[model samples]
Target: MAEEETELSDEQKKEIAKWFLLNAPAGEIQYVAKDLKSVLNADDVYNEAASEAFPVYNKSHMICLGMSGHFGDVLVTSYGELNENEYLDPKTAQVAIVDHVKQVCTEVRPATDEELPSPYIEEYRCALEAEMLKYVSEAYPKGVCSVYCINGKDAEGPGSDFELVVVISAARLSPQNFCNGSWRSIWNIEFKDDIQSLELKGKLQVGAHYFEEGNVQLDTKHECRDSTIFQSPDDSAIAIASVIRHHETEYLASLEESYLNLPDTTFKDLRRKLPVTRTLFPWHNTSQFSLTREISKELGIGK
Candidate 1:
């Protein structure tokens, strides 16, 4: 008779998962027959593992899973990475696993050179970043310089370690008064291998309106459009410009739709006419629309 195989408990499974995530060699693809729920239950473990294994501050290590029944050597099909937030999402993990199993496992063979992580990824990232920066500078003369990409905590607390930022601003007067207008957009660019994750965050103000619509949040329409994926940093920078230009057009449309024929329109009325919806920040009573516009225009974004 054949000997019975021992079954692993949830704890044991997590332990095994943590071990592989923590110690797996960079660019190596290791196979585990059982489906361990480690990726789901262990947030701290993933954070720790990524902290140790992340190729760079802007890039995350990739994780792939195999199905339970297969027994051949796991062959890595591609090389890529995700942001920490993207990596930790259970749905993303599941998709990667299922995709991997579907793409390979029918034959036994070593991963090809193309499937392996780049040997000089650090230098590669630096070169890519330089090219991206140059592109931003040349393509967007109005794009403001910022230190938001710095790698460490700020005086307030932890800060985003984004690789680059493109701040774009646009404003127009009431066609009569200099004190009336709207618009600002900022894109945080996190560079990955052959891809750039662009996050949109900014503020919108209307003529003499007290409330300001700002930041991408769950309840906002812009939230869904917040994170855009691009093939290159140059394309991502162009996207930033495109978003600002769209805002300019939207602002004009809002003026025509909401302000025309209506006298002394309130902020709420103007916002209702805008194309995009966003959370209105009303925390402080002193926050004025005219004031916000002045500050934004004078200092500009990324200052």
Candidate 2:
């Protein structure tokens, strides 16, 4: 009889598959993603677990994780370089940015019942809005807006301290449109004292917000409709959208001298077509647009 082959479990195969995918050349993620299916001998299991859980990461892929994690699509921003010690590696920056947002959303929040808006979130919101106001660029174009300062991030290494602020912005849309939701974007920028570096990388980010009562929301994925809620009409919707959009715009601009590299990402502003929902606060009516989520990102800020 012929010798039989051993089949790896989905988890086991996915571990190996991740390595292959990471090492795969640019634009070959889809092609490499299939190796797990063959190794596992359980297509259904791989599909259920490993298919969407691909964590094949590199410096080229950054900024994909959103602050809220559920609202905006994981988007890619431009690539750039700074000094070595003061360097900006997209992969490390992505980890730092995503982790910072994760921390801000949950760790910083309304301390007392009387807390209006989170103090932490408000600071960044104000500072970020001020920067966006400087530009009449397409994304921020003159409009009544809202800013959610997700939080302030600071990393102290051997030679330098990296301070990053993560925020989301939204710009108003027409009240005439029944599905009124603002266009949104997320951003992260390193606050370098003098700024230096010449290395480069790319990043993508998406966001989501779920509540854990006193703490930040534990999860944003709603397993059941009744247990979760999404609300807000157009007025609140557009403000929400602009805030998220502003985040990335400001982040990208901060990394470069100007907007030349913005074309690869969210340079385009489109609040009119964006579907919106309040992921954290109860706006008015619940929103259920799958492609969009409204966090009111103020959960941890201005409280």
Candidate 3:
């Protein structure tokens, strides 16, 4: 079912306009106007603004004037990332914002040969020479950085003694052009023969929804799997298990805090806490890609 839109109040407009005026990128600031309405989209924009520091690009860009084409109240959309300053006409504001996005797109580029084989990749290559060198020489996986490539790394983990090293390779792509959200550009570690060295058959992908939104500060606690780390044939199991621990911790915490201030906290509630059944032994799938499926689906990447 579609939810009804709630209109913003006068106080809300004042707060929003205040924010827009303050963060308008040094010279982008124009004269502040009186009547701007704030549009809400579920919880992606406003609630996120209250809790997190998101990038400017993640905010809304489309500027819609209410038919008459004159500014009643100057507009403020998004959370100051892409703004239509009150000083310009609606059409001019939209054009200026589009150009701003174009400026941002120019900065994102595929890693070059000198850029590939990152420090982590170099570290892995130093560990095993024959497998890595042989794979690179034969595969020649060179196009876009993520295309025709291998990535390997010793994932520094918490708790366990397993020194897990993972490698992933995708050889069937050309150019594979990635935008801001594409896994190729977002992940900090990009390796060149890490996958080919391990001889794994799994497909590798680095797509993300947040990647396109361009917010680097959002918490990845909801991410069930780290794609590059999880696709490693050798280390995926241990890496996923580690992720499960974090997931379950967050899950349990959420469960405990829910339904606060309920009036039923009496002797009956105490009785509910008593155990009536034997402890159920737990079992886990220990799967990597299984956890990442949702992330991939949301990002429109295939299995």
Candidate 4:
């Protein structure tokens, strides 16, 4: 007689999904979501359901564990990166869909308060400020902004040992945005940073405060780099000009390359669209060492 195969129950399937959600390897969930999206698009059998999950998981196939839904329809209340260490904790057990055929997890939204470890939940609070500070500082490092980090003991909980406060010019990005509880509109972070108080011992806690006009303090207490050079937005333009004049040969060549094979536009129009310029011209160099007028003349713009 042939051995009988035991069919798994819905509860058993859910348990399997939870296990995979907590134990799947890094990037596996995202890859599976991508693969399922391709499958859904190619196959007409699975009814396409609109999703409000992260942009990456949109239109992907899923098997909802909590609700009755179609192939592509699943309510993802929240999601986050699976921490294997938290697998033992029952509260960390998540109710989500899984791709049993592929034996992988599909998607997990941002970590809900109940899902994360006690120590990590507090640190996650400052996620928005941290990301925005990183983005602005990197995008406009030419003195457009400054990042100040402070290291301190976590007075309230043993989980954290430091506090991070960020300051930025309201002209660049308003502070209200951070305080508004609308992080998704600002930027979508795929994986959040893990705050370890021990590793931050030699590191600096960068912070930003909103400032308006005039000169502001750039006294960043970071251990890695000096952020004092970032004084003001206007000064950044001057600094850019100085650096270009200092490296005139190489930069000018790069600038010419950027301008080549492009449609002709007026100097005013070009200056207006300088943000999208393929090359950074010395727009602030107006005194003795200046390329503003020369470049304009070269571009066939009249005085």
Once fitted onto the true fold, the runs of candidate 2 whose alpha carbons sit more than 4 angstroms away are 1-12, 24-28, 35-40, 48-120, 129-163, 166-303
TM-score to native of every candidate shown: 0.26, 0.27, 0.22, 0.18
Q: Tell me, by TM-score, which candidate is best.
A: 2
Model 4 ranges off by over 4 Å: 1-113, 117-124, 127-303
Q: Can you list the residue pairs that collide in candidate 1?
A: none
- Please identify which of the two predictions, 2 or 3, would achieve the higher lDDT against the true structure: 2
Please estimate how well model 1 matches the true structure, expressed as its whole-model Cα lDDT. Answer: 0.36
Better of 1 and 3 by TM-score: 1
Q: lDDT by residue for model 2 over 111-200, one digit each (tens)?
A: 232222233333333454454444324554523222322223221222332322222233232323312222333233332233432111
Encode model 1's per-residue lDDT on 181-234: one tens digit a residue: 222334444444334455545443222322134322111112213455644334
Q: How far out, in Å, is residue 247 in model 3?
A: 2.7
Model 4 — which ten-residue stretch has the worst lDDT? 179-188
lDDT by residue for model 4 (1-34), tens: 9977997554554444434333322223444345
Query: Can you tell me which runs of candidate 1 are displaced by over 4 Å?
Result: 1-163, 168-184, 187-196, 206-224, 261-303
In Å, residue 150's CA in model 4 sits off its true spot by: 22
Clashes per candidate (backbone, < 3 Å): 0, 59, 7, 18
